[model samples]
Structures are given as structure tokens and as C-alpha cells.
Target: MSDKPLHPRTRAIHHGIRRSQYGEMAEALFMTQGFAYDSAEQAEARFIKAGPDEFIYARYGNPTSRMFEDRIASLEGTEDAFATASGMAAVNGALMCFAKPGDHIVSSRALFGSCLYVLDVLARFGVEVSYVDGTDLDQWRAAIRPDTRAVFFESVSNPTLEVVDIAGVAALARAVGALVVVDNVFATPVYSRAVEQGADVVVYSTTKHIDGSGRCLGGVICGTRQFVREVAEPYLKHTGAAISPFNAWLMLNGLNTLDLRVRAQTDSALALARALQDMAGVSRVVYPGLPDHPQYDLVQRQMGAGGTMIAVDVGSKAAAFAAMDRMRVFEISNNLGDAKSIVTHPATTTHSRLTPEVREGLGITPGLLRLSVGLEHADDLIDDLRQALA
Candidate 1:
């Protein structure tokens, strides 16, 4: 066979497949927690240093989980990966593994509520974190100190839909030898070139676009083999953050159609964003793909597509709730990247935990409705939003 790399679509389907003696057509699920050893000496030797195909405990690793890790690593163009119980587990493990008491970390101020909570947890543990406006390169440059251990940010800010300059921030981090850790859930693996753009670590919530149907919760940390095996794995396994084999299998299957699902959803999102902008009730529409977005050029350079989420301001909390109530096709939920379109009032749902002042600073207005566009036809979705706005 010719020595050539496969396309991402092909890799998503065929990579990391391990078939059993039965030679089953489908990927077999190995659900056992512990592996039995052939001999006492063999078990000791394996535990001392498990080979690529060996496993001692489920919390440490499993064949099905390994398959999910390998496939995602390949897709993300990373040397290795570690699957976690949820997206937050991956984020916590990635940041907390190397962050010490005195170590300083810089982060974009616009982050998911849970991510902010994790940073708070780290703060209580003595790690110093500085927050900066992610859209401002100057803010990032000013915040990163010589002692900065890592810089964390959502590649695309949640709810408000601000797109950060991945390459610009990565360059700043490199100057101080700080690791660039990116929450790339919004970018989706299909549109991400985070590794190529100089990110040291890329994290994803497989429950979102990767699963594509809101079926299960899973997350993965993708980076160098040293980071995955030596740094992240030790912390995650010891803390019991391993993804269930069943969830891993579901994520593996989710990867197969990720490209198709995300692209379709993105198209629907753009349509809705454009329609919302001109609608009578909507005062604003935030989507990276829109030409008027503050970071439109960055979105084109980085993701090349708008992505599957949009945020619209319908004027007030009452108006937002009324619009959501009037929706025919969209479901009311906090989750994004689902096959069924979703509408969430961020001030009341996802980001409600944040103080009102903080939410306003992040542009999560009481009137803001976060839209997760689904696989439905663009015209149908647009019509649904039109009536909702009407």
C-alpha cells in the first residue's frame, strides 16, 4: 500500500478499530472493568509497564476507550488522547495536572459557567488565574506573564459567540513558553486546525457536536504523547475521570458522521443568524460567520465556517421567553450541537449562575437567546424563527 495519510472523514470511520477473534463487522464493545492475567509474574510485569494493547483497570484504560482516544487523536492531529467522563473532566484534568500553587495561568474572561467554576476551584487550590478579553490581542499580551504556565480560552466564546485569535494568542503564549490550551468544542473537530495553529492542548466535549445527537456525555484531551500518557492520564485516572466503555463506544460511532452533521448544522445556523438580524424583534445576532461579527476575519482564517451556534438579542427577558415559547421546531434546552434545534435563554439557563453584572460584561443579556441549529432544512428553520420573532 502507498504510504499516504487518509482524509479526516475516512479516518473518523476507519481509525482505531480493533476486532476480536470473532472477526465481527462492527466494533466490539469490551465492557469488563479488570483484565485477568495469565500468570502472577505476567500481571506484575504488565502493571509495572502496560504495553499498547494491555490494560489493568477500567479507570486506567480499556480497549473500547482506547479506540475512542486513538480515533479522536488522529482526527485532532495530536500524538495521543485521554477520554474523560465529561467535557468538564477533560478541562479540569488538562489545567490542574501541571498547575502548581504559585504558577500563574491566563484565561479569556468569556467562558462557560462550569469552566469559570473550575478556575475558581483552582484559585481555591492556590493557582493564580488572570482573565482577559479574548477578542483583544492586547489584553492577552498584557495578561500573560513570564511565570504564566498556561493560557486557556474557548476558541469561540459561548452564548455571545466571540471568536478568539487562536494563532495570535498562541504566539503570545510561545513568547513566555506558556502552554496554549484551547476549549475547541465550538470549532468542532471537522473545522479545527488548532494543532496546526500552535495550540499545545485541544479539549472537546464529545457530548456536543461529536455525539451529534445528545446521546451521551464524553470528553477528550488531545496533545503530545507525553502530555496524554505522562501528565493527563496519571491525574485523570487517579481522580476517576475515565469515560465509560459504553459512552466511549457511542462517541466512536458519533465520530463516524460528525463531519456531515456539523456541516449541515452550521449551514442551518448561518441561515438563522442572517434571518434573525433582519427580523423586527431581534436587536442583535451574534454568529462568527456573519460579516458584521467582530471576529469575522478570524473565523474565516481559523474555522472557515460559522459553526453551529448563534446568539440573538430579542430585546428583553420577557420578549426572549415569548419568542422561545412561540418556537415550533426548536426545543427549549441549554444543550447545543444537537440534531434537534435548541433555543436557550442564557440569562435564565446556562449562564444564570454568573452574577448579573458578570453576565452583562460577557454580553449574556437578559434578552439573549442562544440557538443551536440542527439538521432541519434551512428554510424550515428560518420560518420557525420568523414566526417566533413575529
Candidate 2:
């Protein structure tokens, strides 16, 4: 094979295919908990220093899981990656690895409910956390400090779809020697060049677009080899947030079609956003792709497109729920980046626990509905919405 790097679509299919002597075309699933050594002396030698191809325990590493890690790492343009049991596992683990009792963490206020929970948990552990408006560089500058250990945020905020300035924040973080960690779920790996944009660590809920089918729960942490192996891996292996071999295999399968799936979904999303924008009761189209969105320029400069999700604000919560309920093509769901279109009422399902004021601040209005566009025909999806809105 040539030393030239492969395109992401090609890499997704063949990047980490470690075929066994059986010469199987599909990647082998090594469903094992522990590896046996040739002898007692060999076992001791192996424990002293495990070789690259050697395995100690499943929790520490597994072939199937490693393949998933390698494939995602290659796709993410990162030096290495660690697979986790779930997206929250990846998010919480990445933070926990470097965060200490006296350390300060500066984070964007716009966050998923679960992402907020991780920072909340850290605060109780003696870590000082400052929440800022992700879109405002001023808030980030004000909150970030000389001793800040890390700055965390979703590159694209959940439910509300706020787009953060990654390069700007990365510059702020770099000035303070703080790591810039981004949860990049909304911006799928298909279009993500977050590392190129200066994110020190990028995280994703592979459960969303990577799996594309919503088959299994998985997440991956990607960063420099030193950061992934020395920081995150040690904590993960000991604390036990490893992805299963079965799930890894599913993720492996998911990668094969990820490029195709995400692009289709994104196109469908942009189409739907346009259709919904001027509708009778719809007050706003919150998609970054819309030219009218507050962060449209940032969307163009950052991800080169609006992305796969669309958030719309209807007139009222009752109208929002009614619009969601009347949809025939889109499933009422909390999940996104799936094969089937999904519409979520954020005020009731995902962000329901937040106070009305807090929800309002994130732009997650009472009438806001988060739309995760899927692989459905654009015309049919629009027609379903048109009738529902009427």
C-alpha cells in the first residue's frame, strides 16, 4: 500500500482491519477477558512490559475495541483514541483524568443535561468550575484563568444548537496552558476537523451518528497519544468504563456507512430547516445552516456546513408538542443521527429538569423542538411536517 493517507470514507472501511490467520474479510471480534501467556516466566515478562500486540486484560485493552479506537482515531485526525462504555463515560473520563481538587475548569454554559451533570459532579469534588456563554469570547476570557486546568464545551450546543468559536477558545486556552476539550457529537466526524481547528481533545457519542442506526451505546476520546494513553487510559482501565467487544464490532460496522449516512441526513436537515422556516406557526429555525442563524458565519468557517441537527421554535409548548405528535415520518425521540428522523421536545424530555429561566438562557425555549434529520426522503418528511403544522 502507498504511504499516502486515505480519504475518510475509505479509511472508515479499511483503516483498522486486523485480519487473523483465518483470512476473514470482516474484522475479527476477539471476545476475550484475559490473555494467557506461554509460561509462568513469560507471564511475568509480559506483565513487566506488554508489547504493542500483546494483551493483558480486556478492560485494559481488547482487539475489537482497539480496532474501533484506531479506526475512529484515524477518522478524527487524532494521534490516539480510547473507547468508552458510553458518551458520558468518554466525557466524564476525559475530564476526570486531569482534574484535581484544587484545579479550575472553565466551561461553556450551553450544555447537554448530562454534560452539565459531569461538571456538577466535579464541583462537589472540590474542583472549581466557571460556566460562561460559549458563543461570547468575552465570557470565556473572563472565566479562564492562569491556573485553569481545562476548558470544556460542546462545539455545537445540544437541543439549542449554539455554535462555539473553537479556534478562538483554543487560543484563549492555549494562552493559559489549559487543554481545550470539545464534545463534538453534533458536528459528526464526517465533517469534523476539530483538531485542525486547535481542540486538544475531541469527544463524541458514537451512539449518535457513528452508529447511525442507534444499535449500541459507545463513545470515543481522541487526542495526542500521550494524553490518551498516559492520562485517560490509565483512569479508564482502572475505573472500568471500557466499551464491550460486541459493541465495538457494531461500531466497526457503523463506521463503514457513517460517511454516507451523515451526508444524507445533513442534506435532509437543511431541506427541512428551509421548509420549516417560513411555516405558519413556526417562530424560528435554529439550524446553523440557515443563512439567518446567529452563527451562520461561524458555521461556515468551522464545519463548512450547518450540520445534521435542526432546532425550531414554534409559538408555544402546546404547539411544539402538537407539531411533534403530528409528525408521521419522524419518530418522537431523544436520540439523533439515527436512520429514522427524530423530533424531541427539549423542554419536556432532555432539558426538562432545568428551570424555565435556565432553559430560556440556552435558547431552549418552551416551544423549541430539536429535530435530528434522518435518511428519510426529504419531500415526504417535509409533507409530513406541512400537514402537521397546518
Candidate 3:
């Protein structure tokens, strides 16, 4: 079974199962901080030279966490993965593991506000970081320097949903011997081929689509085994950024239906985006599935679908707020990729720390509203939006 190349859906269900003596149907949660040994000599041998499937500490590894990591890696087509306490932990770990003082990084200017702080504030302590327009090949080309250690970007950026050319940027990073790191939240793993397209590392906030129920805060960094086990695991375990066994269990359950939920939400998002495209007060609609999107061609080639998120410029902040307040079904919130529909105002919420000028540069306008479609009926959500806009 280990040598067989099963489909992703199959792997998600059975890839990392380690049955106990009881041979339970579901993966068991160890919920332990440390493991015990039979004798002093046995403990010494285990520590000195661990076997193929040995456990040292919960922070280092656990049965539940390992199951979630293995399942996600299989789904993402990566060699291995490291689960983290939260999405930001995954983001920070992925970048901090391979970077050091005097190192340089090139990244997209359009990113989640927290992600921006990680690169701009944290990385600035030692590493030199440069920001560029992710969609422009020329900007990325110019930003890559001989000293660039890595290039990072949200494959489909946050609120605004700007799609980056993963293959193109990966090519540039490869030429400069830099790793290509992608935060593939918007491009849910169901619709993502970042690895196949050349991404060296892919990060996800399992808090989002992976735990579609909004029940847990978890994240994972997926990449080659050497990078995941050797690089990410060391930083994560030492710094105490490991996901809880309970959270890992929740995420593992979430993975079982990730494909179905994301696809359903994406269908609703497409319908809603199209329904509101020419509606009154909507100045612009940004959805990769739309022909008018700047990177629609690339989106079709790379993602195969527009995805489960949509962004709209609703004329002004006042109008955007009015629409949000009027919506009965869509909840106004900052968190996304949940079972419930969520709307966010990036300029004032997620990206509020950025100056108006910087926000504008990223197309995060005062009137822009980001909609994360959920498992609601398309017509119901459309009608709610219609009444709100009316």
C-alpha cells in the first residue's frame, strides 16, 4: 500500500493511519506531552537512535498531528509537511527556517496584513526584504537579486484576490537559486497545483478551508521531506509552534470533506460574482473566473477554477458598510474560508495598518469588500445581496 500511487481522495482517508493494538476505525489522538519507555536502557536506545516510527515528545511529533500532516502533504503533492499552531505560525516558520541575518527576500506587496508584518517587521530585524507587484513578471524579474534567498507570495492574494503567475515567478526564483514559497489559501488545495507548477513550498492556514467548520486554528507547511522535517520541524518544535492534538484531530476531520465544501463554495461564489457584476453601485468585481479579471487567462491555466472567494469595489466605504450591514445571510467578519459566508473590508480591517497610499497600491480600496462564499444556496445568497444593494 505504501508503494502504490493512490488518488488524492483515497490518500486523504487512509494515507497516515497507524492503528493501535485495538485497530480502531478512526485515527487515535495520543493527547500526551511525552512518551514512556520500558526501561532506562530502552529510553537511552530510543533517544540515541530512534526507530522508523518512534516518538520523542508531543511538541516534536504526535500520532494525530502526523496524520494531519501526512494527509495534507498527500493532498498537496509534497514530500512531507509540518503542522503549526496557527496560520501565522506556519507562515513565520516557513520563512524563518531558511532565512538568517544578512539574507534577502523578495515578496509580493499584496498580502494579508499579518503576513505583511511578518515580512516587513520581523524579517527586517535581520533579513533584507523587498516587495514587488506579484502579477507583473517584470517587477518580479527586477526584484530578484543574486543574494535573494527566497520569494514569497500568496498564490491568490488575500481580500483583493489577485492571482500571481506561480510558474513564472518560480522560474525567476529558480534562476536566482531562491526558493518559491506560496501561501495558497485563496487557491484552496482542491483547485491548486502550486507544487506541480513549481512552487518549492506551500503554506496553508488550516483555520481556513481545511477546517471548514471554523472549529480549529491550525496551519501546515508543505514541501520536500528535507525542508519539512529538517528545516521547518526544527524551528517549529523548538519555538513551540506545534498544533494541539485536538486541533490536529479537527483538521483531520475537516480534510475528509475539503474537496466537496470548497467546490460547492466556489460554485456559489462564481454565481454571486456574475449576478453582481452589472448591479448598481458595484464599480468593479474581481473574481478569477470572470473574463474581465486581469489574470483570468493565467487563472484558467493554473487553478482550473475561479475559486471560492470574490472581491468587489462597491463605490465607497459608506456604501460598502451599508451593504454589509444590510446583509442577513452574509456575516461581516475578518476570518474567511468557513462554513458560513463572511465579508471583510480589507482597507479598514485586514489591511488597516497600511497607509491609504499603500493600500491603494495593492488595490485594497476604501470601498472594496471581500466575500468568502460558503455552503449557502446560491439563490439565497444572491437575493440577500440584491436586497442589501437595493
Candidate 4:
């Protein structure tokens, strides 16, 4: 059974089961801060070399969290993974673990607000950083240098839904011997082929799709065993960014239905995108699945779907606000990838803190509204959106 390979959905359901003697059906939650040893010598030996199942502290690791890590790693096509407190923590830890003073990294300019903050923090610590238009291959090629340490970007950027060329950028990074780290949140695990596209590390905010019901906040860094254990582990464990056992348990449970939820949401999102695409009130609709998308070809080549989120511009902030206020089915909130459909006005919410020039550069106009389609019925959502426009 251990030697047999399984599908991602199968792995998501039963990848890292360390059942106790009871043989419980569900994964057990090991809510513990520390573990005990039988003898003094045993404790010392365990400290020096902890066995695969043995654990010293919850901060370092726990059975429940380990299961989450292993499960996510298996799902992500990586040898190992480390769960973190939040998605930003995973991103920061992943980047900080690999980079130090004088090391350089190239990043896409279009990123979530929190992600930009991480890069700013990295700069203060003496790391050199460069930002480029994620959609433009020439910009990435010019920015990535032979001495660069890593290249980081969201495969599908937040708010704007700008799809990055994963294989294209990965090739450029590889030429410079740089590590490829992708934030694979928007392109959920169901559609993610980042690792196969030459990414060295894949990070996900398990808080999103992994915990689809908005129940828990957790993140994971997936990569080779050596990188997770030797590079990321020390930083994550020492910096105190480990995930709670309970949250890990929630994430584990969420995985059981992730494929179903994401697919349903994607279908609804596609329908909503098409419904709102040509509406009089909507000036532009940005969904990779849409025919008008500049990167539609790349989206097809990369994820094979438009994903569960859509962005629409209503021509002005007033019109966008009016449309959002009139919507009945979608909740107006900043969170994305929730079971409850969410509508976010990026210019005033998520990306509000960004400079005007930066926002303009990334095309985050005042009228831009990001819609995270949920598991709602497609027709109902489309009707609600149509009513909002009216």
C-alpha cells in the first residue's frame, strides 16, 4: 500500500494517516505542547535524533500538524512540507529561509497587500529585491539575474486576477540558477501544477481553499525534504510560526472536500464571469476563462480552468459601490475563496494601501471589484449579479 501511487483526491483523503491503536476513522487531533519520554537516556537520544513519529514540542511539531504537513505535501507533489500560522508567515518563512543579507530576489509587482509587506520587510534586512510586471516575459527575463536567490509570484495574482506565466518564468529563473517559489493560493491545489512547471517551492494559505468554510487559518510550505527539514524547519520552528494542532485538524478535514468545493466554485465563477462580461454596468471582466483575457492562452496552458474568482470593473467607484450594495447573494468582504460568495472592492479594501502609481501600474482601478464565487447555484448567482447591475 505504501508503494502504490494514488490520485490527488485519494491522497487528500488518506495520505498521512498515523492511526492510534483505536483505529479511528477520522484523523486524530493531538492537542499537546510537549511529549514525554520513558527514561533520561531515551529523552536525550530523542532530543538528538527524533524518530519520524516522535515529537519534542508542539512548537517544533505535533502528530496532528505533521499529518497535515504530510498530506498537503503529498497533494502538492513535494517530498515534505511545514505548516505555518498563516499564509503570510509561510511566504515570509519560505523567502527568509532561503535568502539572507546581500542575496537578491525578483518578484512580480502585482501581489496581495500582505505579500508586498513581506518584501518590504526583506529589504530592511539587507536583501536586494526587484519587482517586474508578472505578465510580461521580457520584464521577468530582464529582472532575474544569475546571482539572484529566488523568483516569487502569485500564479494568479489577487484582486486583478492577472495570470502569471508559470513555465515561462520558471525557465528564466532556472537559467539564473534561482529558486522558483510560487504562491499557489488563487490557483487552488486542484488546478496547481506549479511544481511540475519547475517551481522549487510551493506555498499555500491553507486558510483559503484548504479550509474552505472560513473555519481556520493555516498555511503550508511544500518542497523537497531537505529544504523543508533543513532550511524551512529551523526558521519556522524557532521563529514561532507553527500552526495550531486544532487548525491543522480543520485543514485536514477541509481537504476531504476541497476538490468538490473548488470545482463547484469554479463552475459558478465561470458562469458569473460570462453573465457579467457584457453587462452594461461592467466595463471589464477579468477571468482567465474569458475569451477576451490577454492571457487566456496561458491560462489554458497552465491551469486548464478559469478558477473560482472573478474581477469586474464597473467604470467608477460609485457604480461599483452601488452594484455591490445592491447585490443580495454575495457578501461584501475582503476574504476570498470562501464557501460564502464574497465581493471585494480592491481599490478601497485589499489594495487601498498601495500607492496610486503602483495601483495604476497593476491596473487596480477604483471601479475594480473582485468576486470570489462560492458553492452557490450558478443561475441564482447570475440572477443576483444581474439584479445588482440593474
**How many clashing pairs per prediction, in order?**
0, 0, 0, 0
True lDDT of residue 369, candidate 2: 85
Off by over 4 Å in 1: none
| Global CA lDDT computed for model 1 | 0.93
- Model 3 spans > 4 angstroms off: 1-4
In model 1, pairs of residues that clash are none
Candidate 3 vs 4: which has more TM-score: 4
Tens digit of per-residue lDDT, candidate 3, span 190-229:
9989999999999999999999988879999999999998
Prediction 2 global C-alpha lDDT: 0.91
Candidate 2 per-residue C-alpha lDDT over 214-285 given as tens digits, one digit per residue, 9 for 90 to 100:
889999999999999999999999999999988999999999999999888889889999999778898888
What lDDT would each prediction earn against the true structure? 0.93, 0.91, 0.91, 0.92
Query: 195 in model 4: Cα distance from truth in Å?
Result: 0.4
Write down the TM-score of every candidate. 0.99, 0.98, 0.97, 0.98
| Candidate 1 per-residue lDDT over residues 102-131, each given as its tens digit | 889999999999999999999999999999
For residue 385, give model 3's deviation from the true position in Å.
Answer: 0.5
- Candidate 1: Cα lDDT at 291: 95
Clashes of 1: 0
**lDDT, residue 204, candidate 2:** 94
